[model samples]
Target: MKRHFNTTGPVIPEQHYCVDPMTRLDWEDVQYLIGAGKFFVLHAPRQTGKTSTLLTMMDVLNQSDEYQCLYINVEPAQAARDDVSAGMLTIVNNLVEGAAIRLKETRLRDWRETIWRNSGPHGAFSALLSRWAQESDKPIVLMIDEVDALVGDTLISLLRQLREGYIGRPGIPFPHSVILCGVRDVRDYRIHTKHHEIITGGSAFNVKAASLRMVGFNRAEIETLYAQHTAETGQAFEPMVFDALWEDTHGQPWLINAIGHELTWKDKTARDRSTPITLERYRAARERLIYSRSTHLAQLADKLREPRVHRIMAALLTGDENLSGIPVDDLEYVNDLGLVEIRPQIRISNRIYQEIIPRELTWVEQSSITHQQAWYLTPQRHIDMPKLLSAFQQFFRENAEAWIERFDYKEAGPQLLLQAFLQRIINGGGRINREYGLGRKRTDLFIEWPVDEEKGFYGDVQRVVLELKILRKSLETTLLEGVEQTAGYADQCGADEAYLIIFDRRLNVDWDDKIWQRQEQWQTRSIGAWGM
Candidate 1:
């Protein structure tokens, strides 16, 4: 009775879940870590199924008769702040008891009580493994989940004890292999404890041998999940829907599931029959979900607002990929956050996130624009492009300043605002196609206005390519660069006309009211003012 789509973490029992791709992560390269009895760290972004992978790994290791394996979650122990060492003790005791219960060995169960009697939590953990290895004739492996939850001096003490105890291994003592799992690489930890002024966990826990990362589902996995949903519900997903979903999410597991979950559970009306999900429905569902500013979108927006994310995102939004040489902290931070993938050229990870950034940033501004329904439609039911552009000119003269301020990313707001203006006019029968990013020179927005005329006549396809430029360096320098950039983009899009709007916030000279100057056979145009 469980639906396949899950917005939260990995689905549990009764709920069908995909096998984590990272679960197949091998420890071959770091076998020395296991052999030396050193701590191992595995981490990734939240909800990327780190816990699920650990559990699966623990099960596999436990099945092997050579090693007794146990996975313990220390998240609950985090609640006890002031007495952190006591919290560690409590977590160790609980972990021992839980493992003993699972193993169902009375002697091992007694060992749990024996270990807890010791003064040190680390000593207790070591004792339990020592007893288990000696009695069962097998080495013991320990997997600690939410290891980062242990804070301050508690975290330091735990790491130090494990490092100190590494000397007693193999024949005499200590767990064979120790795995610490959390949201960040252990080497990046900056633990601040009341007792220790500033304890850099990386230096304290240099004993971490291997830092493994968990990755999300790929394209094949995405299709398989949707297919499973279709098989179960007997409701088909349109062919184009799959392509659209793949294009949007790019196999991001969370987004893939979220879209499906929203479409099936949230968007469906009571009277609507169990029908196949279409591309239109999927789009509507995504737009609605984004507009609602759900937890997923809100959290993503919050990341965008961070100073680290802000700079990198601004560069990406304005399509400034030249920061490749500039050592910006925000660039690295945003890349680490997985918002933008680091490659030969830094860019947003996928289409869905790329689409999300602009929409989430500009939704407030778009909502404020008054309805201009009359200007777009004609008596013959065809779109009036001249009327639409005239309206945009008036809008640019009036609301551009106020609207741009409302945008989350004011740098790219002007272009988005223009799109919003054009979108209102053309969205009725026409669609807008956008392409933007870093190193791409300029952001190219293509507005497709389709018009149906008489029977023999071809559909009036109006393609408007808008090129956005920022006011930095020099207008001539940027414009020369923009012209070449816009030319290439216009050629690719096969656009009939291209409008190069320079948003000059740095201009000191007064405008001559109507400054619409065209150059090079009308291939390019320049306009400057407060906004328009």
Candidate 2:
């Protein structure tokens, strides 16, 4: 069977082109932790190969005589919610099934019923592990995936049970090591109990030795994974595709595989295995993936509705540097969700996310926009950017008050509205790239429109840059800074035209006072400036 990219589940080595899951982490550290009989947490963002890594580790350990490892997902118990009995029953049953399937051990299934009857929900899980460990010749390692998916008292009970087992360790008949895998570290779990009490996972599972995060693939790993396809099919990817892929995905595993699958399997032309994939093909695939709103991307968009996610995302969207109001935990939470990176600076994780965030936020507005693409095109087939901006100004004046109030992220209303308007006009014929972050104080929008319809992006292309800013300082200072910033971005993009749009959101200001437009020159560039 031909190996292909695996996007949906844990990678099967013989069936998928993959990077070795073992190399994604520090195997040495993992071995040390396991050997020391210490319980640890392994976590990363969703679909980032946490389950795959755990399964691979289980296989490697089971192959040796040193340890008997079993990997099971506890997500099914999430449906039980606060019902500890139901949740624990589901988890225990899953363990029995996993042992039979993966370890070829039927002992768990034989012993689980009596153990649950005697020990009950609170102690059954720990009792089951203790029994399994006692019977096995090798020290057992239990890897529990999606540990955070359990809710309320159900989650609390599981953690407490794990903590109870940790007390026995190697001296007693308990698993030698326990690994809890989830989208967030155990320390970040804010579990709510039935009595309206809050129990932090750290407090419940205080026996945890360490938390190890699994990061996404680096450049070399990406290349190695992609090269597997080239070797098998004889279809090569152009060198430029790698650069674009990196920018679009930042080595995200699902994204890399998704794009690869789209290019190789979905597009029948590229399936010939002789037509080398090019930069244009990669871009088209990316747009399709984004527009498809796949489960992964949809989950990411759904997170924006969360209070913690909303706080950080709103700050990033409006370029608000006063993040003092947002808690550190909120930032870490969003980071763990894979929505934003909280390192050198807080920004959207990658270009694809950056595009999705704004687009998803304004999807409703963009859909309602009834403007025609041809209306904003010049007779020569180029985008009439000036006319487009003028139309937006009129629209904003008429509807900004009503539409802006409708957004959950009201602070970013102007910026999102402008993006929706642009996206509506450029739906098929062009693309817009956005740049905004914590301290940017400005949002940069780059429009790429292919002047020739036949050639698309390969032919004569018109590039336009729009810099969006909220009036934070004196009018003169804001205008001066806006012109320089807009000019700088245009220069970087080598754009044919540039515009500076300042949204004056003061309630006291009238439409006559707030709306204006002018042309300005900075250095060697001419920039159009607008006030709103």
Candidate 3:
């Protein structure tokens, strides 16, 4: 009954099972925060399990006997932003409430008295920490989640208050340690937006001794998670399933858990045998998980639309190697959000994200005639190249205006959308191998469909190699370039047939005269015209 994969948010505490996917991280990372008597910051993108990690760490610290750890979300402070005093008041109250809930102390008389002694909110926070330190036998540790939810003056006041109280370590009667958790690093926080100036938050919130980033699940962790499912459910994950999962997800925790959860919990109809999940099943599960674009993915993609996220993603999607010249401010912003890892030439953080970004950003196909509906069209089992192209030609004519308008990054041209159009239909049953990026010269897409010949089924396969290019001033140069470029991909893929799709955004040609024509007798390729 346990799902073999999960492609969503952090695995739920116990109702939904999980594994410690990240071995590189340990309590030791947070241990330093506790020992230093300093403020600490833990940041990563939303749904990467910041809350889980914080709760788990709280458990770890509380068991040590020497420390009393209390974790709370300062989200209530968000709406009180108009009045800094009110926001601060809400935050302190939430902290007290959170502490009381865990400690089961209805009233910490001394803590309450000290918290309200000061003239301002910052003074109140200091006094409260001071009193708590004096009353409690164990050193106090505070964890605040969703710290970023407090914005503008509210955020500034919170950071300033914490910074002002930073000196209360061993000698001073303040909380021994504190942790601020959010979607950004303390150093990257632009709490104020006056005059378009970035006042580095680190300067104001300099108390952060260290900032720890939580990475997604790795290969071994993914395997262990599935193994846990196998151990509980009696059904196993096939060896190929592991390989496919690794290749597809590359250890994204949300994706790993979500894929398994869908296959196990959501798609009951797909489950028949008590045996391991096969590679085909895994692929099917992956497609379904992606198509659903469930909450987990929605949260992840929400960041993609931010300016910082957009810049980094655009560069990655376009393969702009010139990203070396990208401003440090933007990179820091994006890196803090976990859009792309810093090392290894600044690639997308992981494979799951890589796959999701294109599909998430691409045009959505809506029709009663779904790709699955078209599945029957290939009943003879061979992909009808002519028919597929003709269908797309008609589809493009009818929908290009509307669909092209939906595209956000038109600078890369409409070729990407064209591939995405054909991709939605083929992705489930087949695979669309995409090779595009900056300085790559051209984008290439290869669509491969498998045929089953054993059920007296004929082995009819479709191999399509599509080359996309942008049209400039003259059609002559673009077409000549496309011919040379497409010829290579066709030969490389050994495509049974190839088509060159030139997106004429400029609309130099007459729309009524648009034609799909074949080119080069020797190369055995066809060229299509879809223009304004």
Cα lDDT, all candidates: 0.66, 0.91, 0.68
Candidates by lDDT, descending order: 2, 3, 1
Residue-wise C-alpha lDDT for candidate 2, range 1-532, written one tens digit per residue: 7999999999999999989999989999999999998999999998999988998898899887799999999999999999999999999999999999988999888899899999999999999999988999998999999999999999999999999888866576899999999999898899999999999898999998999988888988888899999998888999999988898888789999999888888888888888999989889888888888899988889989998888789988999888886778778888888888878878889999999998899999999988889998889999998898899999999999999898889999999999999999997989999998899888999999999999999999999999999999999999999898899899999999999999999999899999999999998889999988
325 in model 3: Cα distance from truth in Å? 4.6
Tens digit of per-residue lDDT, candidate 3, span 242-322? 787876665666677778876676768546538567666676677777778778677778777776667667766754456
Q: Can you give the lDDT of residue 393 in candidate 3?
A: 66
Residue ranges of candidate 1 with Cα displaced over 4 Å: 17-38, 77-90, 93-137, 148-158, 167-172, 194-199, 230-240, 263-278, 322-333, 361-434, 446-465, 473-484, 487-498, 511-531
Off by over 4 Å in 3: 1-14, 21-26, 81-83, 105-114, 117-122, 167-172, 192-199, 269-273, 364-406, 423-433, 448-461, 471-495, 504-516, 520-532
Total clashing pairs for each candidate: 1, 0, 16
What TM-score would you give candidate 1 relative to the actual structure? 0.75
As a whole number from 0 to 100, the lDDT of residue 83 in candidate 3 is: 74
Q: Roughly what TM-score does model 2 have, to 2 decimal places? A: 0.98
| Top lDDT prediction, candidate number | 2
Measured by TM-score, the strongest candidate is 2
Better candidate number, 1 or 2, judged by lDDT: 2
lDDT of 2 at 467: 95
Candidate 3 residue 59 C-alpha distance from true site, Å: 1.7
Model 1 clash number: 1
